[model samples]
Target: MAEGGQIDTDILSDEAFDVLCSMCKNQGKNTEGEQYCVDCKDYFCVSCVKVHSKVPLCAGHKVLDKSQIKSRTSKGLPRAPTERCDRHSHKHIDMYCQKHDTVGCSTCMAVDHRLCKDTFYIPEFIQNNTYQVVATREIQTKLKALDTILAEKADRFKQDKQRLLKRKAEILADIRKFRQEINDHLDKLEKSSINEIEDKVKSLEDKIKDSLKQLQANKSRITSINDKLTSTNTNQSEVFVYVKMAEDAATVAYKYIDDSELQCTTEDIEYQPDITIPTQLEEKKTLGTLAKKHTKTSVSLFQI
Candidate 1:
């Protein structure tokens, strides 16, 4: 079995022979190129290619490049058990099973999916039911707009509250200053009235002191005359004591005047600013449900 007068065993040993055979099996030397088909286990040149299939035993299989075959096979291989039909493990659930109200693969449609109708591809189903999706999206947009408006309104409320408080403090300060001026005016009026009454009382006291001194002098003169008459003991000698008494009564009256009762009047002052607070709109529960439903639909579409 030597091609060049050397025994074939010299080039290939028992271990090396198996390795070479495996390499030939994988590469398919007769067909050419590095890639090979899984079903045919044969390599083919670019010009000699035919078709491939996503699901085996179906009409037209996807044509694949020789170089990309390995990557494709790796990607398409199944791992754990999926919702896809067991009969056709390679085919994913791609259509709605109307009988079960669920999605299923092609095999389920043909077999276990009983009495199923209105089956459609995932894309086709989404395309047909677009109105629901559009309505849901509109609700989500409105919710977002409401949230933004609420944020702005809250900021404005804070600013307005701060401004109003500042104005109120200023008004209170003005009121306090006005009150102080009124008190000062009352104090000055009362002080002037008290000083005038004190001056009048001092003048009356001086006049009463002079009248007492005059009465004391008259009493001394009368006593001296009586002593002379008693010492002389002569009836013919005339010793005369002259006394003049006039009853006179005069009343001094003091009247007090209150400054507040006189000419003082207060004017009512009122400060009012036009203020309007926005009423909070009631949150519609239906919109929230619509938003959530649309979010789920979007996630499902992304997965597809």
Candidate 2:
């Protein structure tokens, strides 16, 4: 036995460093033998290397040292034999036995797979297909998952849009209600002020009418007394009494006349409402800071 089990000297010679040729065994010179692959440990001559390279399945194997092969075999690792099987040790399973689902040497093939017609070489089977079929189902599953994720993201975006729209409508309705309240308050204040101004104007007109009537009566009496004094046969005492009465009426009318009332003063008043709507709200536009100040005055009449 070599290291682990019995050695097959027909495949490897213990004296020579080169592996045996699979075509011509011990009869050929050792220099005529082929180089062996380090990874797969398969022997191939110059011509065999060329033919193996042309074949699709065996093109990727690397060739290395024969001494390295011995070290690997001593360590209980499989070595590429000249005519033995790649899987089984000490048993050269050459021909594939389909009935038993295994490869066999001449003895095994004759014994186990004699009538089995489904057997084939490994190289021929691998060359018939260009790509591996094991990864197809896994790739399809990942693609389906990615599609589902994208669809869910699209639905979420649509739902978010609808929610935003509802929120926007609610905000707009609130703004409108606030604006209406501001307008109603302002209108009430303006109406109250107008009514107060009209009442003051009516009282001032009545006082003005009473003063004008008194002034007209004083003027008429003074004119009549002067005409009597200018007559040819005039009474001095009667004329004097008429003049005294006219003078008293004139003083009374002057006191009753409201001189300060007719002189109205316009005061520039500024009012900032407690509940003020923005200028933008009044204009019914988007809010911005653009305003210009113009002076506005209110006139009020008062008696001295």
Candidate 3:
């Protein structure tokens, strides 16, 4: 209904004044409407009212006839479902059952809740329920606290997520760095081992060269003796040959280097990388729950 729009007449209070017809061309404020469409929750002119009964969805809507409505200036607004029973729409809830903690009409009392207690008045209950009053008042503060606590917890949850991610990245970086260190250590060990083997080979080569040189000198000495004997017509002293024999049994027992001592072997080296994170930390998906608690305010207002 548009503002400043009055009822149709003094006697007959038409419901058409509360809301303006949406289908009408009158966007002006004063629409002295005639009929009320409950489904659309709007007021309509006589002409537009007929369209509501003919339309598909609007046809099923319960409309309050013009005769049932009155103006605010008359008897004020009528008592709505507050006095009426939710279960029995036509009857008012006049009785209360203490045992079942519910309200009902006369028919409901007789048929279902037969053995109920005294008729507990709702107004008295609302006034005297001190626990409900105190709790509701306290819940106002608690409701505000929920928002503040949840905000703080949410910030902490984000911080924890950030920290967890940073720590995870750090652990992974450490693993990579450790791997690089192992590679460098292995490179050093390999270089040292190869240098050792090269030194041993050089020493063996020098010894073999010395042995070959001595053998060559011995051959030269034997050749010189043979020449001298031939020149003397096989008349050279026998002592000379004896002296050659005594020359250190060098030729006969040429002290050979033991090759068996240079057997192949491997160095002692190994790698171990182990880490552990708490199973609880790994399994948990969220930190905790953040929810508004049920309290007297919610239960009273929403009938929870």
Candidate 4:
């Protein structure tokens, strides 16, 4: 098991080790893994190793003691059976054919790949194609750079959305404040015009009240003269004098009331509420974009 309790496929399990040793089980008394036959790609018990060494064909095969066998895999790849070919049963894959981009055994090289332009032993091929290994590492580097670029762009986009939302709130607040200022200014103008109209009307009302009071006093004087003349208790000359004085006062007061300019109208000083958003805030553009491209390369793993 791995660190997280997940099964690690690269390590050989007990059951798999038992299965590999089964090939030598018939010849062995003690069936416990003690050695690995590299050529046969199998595990062998102690008795099985003695028998395998005696055979002429198996004698040439490479053997490893259990303690000498490496357990961990390389580059996360399971320990590949490099001693045998996948296509040919028990045949060793020692030749690499550059023309076909594949590794094959002796029979495969003699038949289908005899006319191939370039061929070499697997060890020589790997030694000669170090450039291909470098190229693969370069590709990994490029991909890692792309990962960083994508992560940064994603973070920038997230920040852009957040910033735009915050800026919208700020602009809304400014607009509301401007609207309130406009309303307040209009309120001030309306109140001033209304006060002026009220003052004009009040002044005209006071003047009218004063004129009525004077007319009432003149009527009282005229009535007093009539009562004296009818009762024969006053002189006719004094009654004529009272009538003349009342007539002069009446004509002047009536003319002044009719001629005085005491009217007020809101048509000249009416307040209006009209506001338009300024030019800078009216722009319609939202945001921008970025573009990236990938190019093809002419390189092959088999080419050195």
- Give the number of the best model, judged by lDDT: 4
lDDT of 3 by residue, 61-138 (tens): 545566745543453332221234456665544344446545555566666755544433322232223323333234
Ranking by TM-score: 3, 4, 2, 1
Residue-by-residue lDDT tens digits, candidate 4, 131-160: 233333343343334334434433433443
**lDDT, each prediction:** 0.31, 0.38, 0.39, 0.42
Q: List the pairs of residues colliding in candidate 3.
A: 1-18, 1-19, 1-20
- The TM-score between candidate 4 and the true structure equals 0.24
Q: Which window of 10 residues has the lowest lDDT sum in candidate 2?
A: 295-304
lDDT of 2 by residue, 1-304 (tens): 1111222223333334445544445346443444565334456566655665676655544453343233223332233222343344334332343354444444555555556655533222222224243233333333334334434433433443343334334433433454456545444444443344344434434443454454445444444433433441232222222333334443443443344234322221122232334443353322111122222222111210
lDDT of 1: 0.31
Ranking by lDDT: 4, 3, 2, 1
Cα-based TM-score, every candidate? 0.20, 0.22, 0.30, 0.24
Q: If both were scored by lDDT, which would come out higher, candidate 2 or candidate 4?
A: 4
The TM-score that candidate 3 achieves is: 0.30
* C-alpha-based local distance difference test score of model 2: 0.38
Model 2, residue 300: displacement in angstroms?
Answer: 54
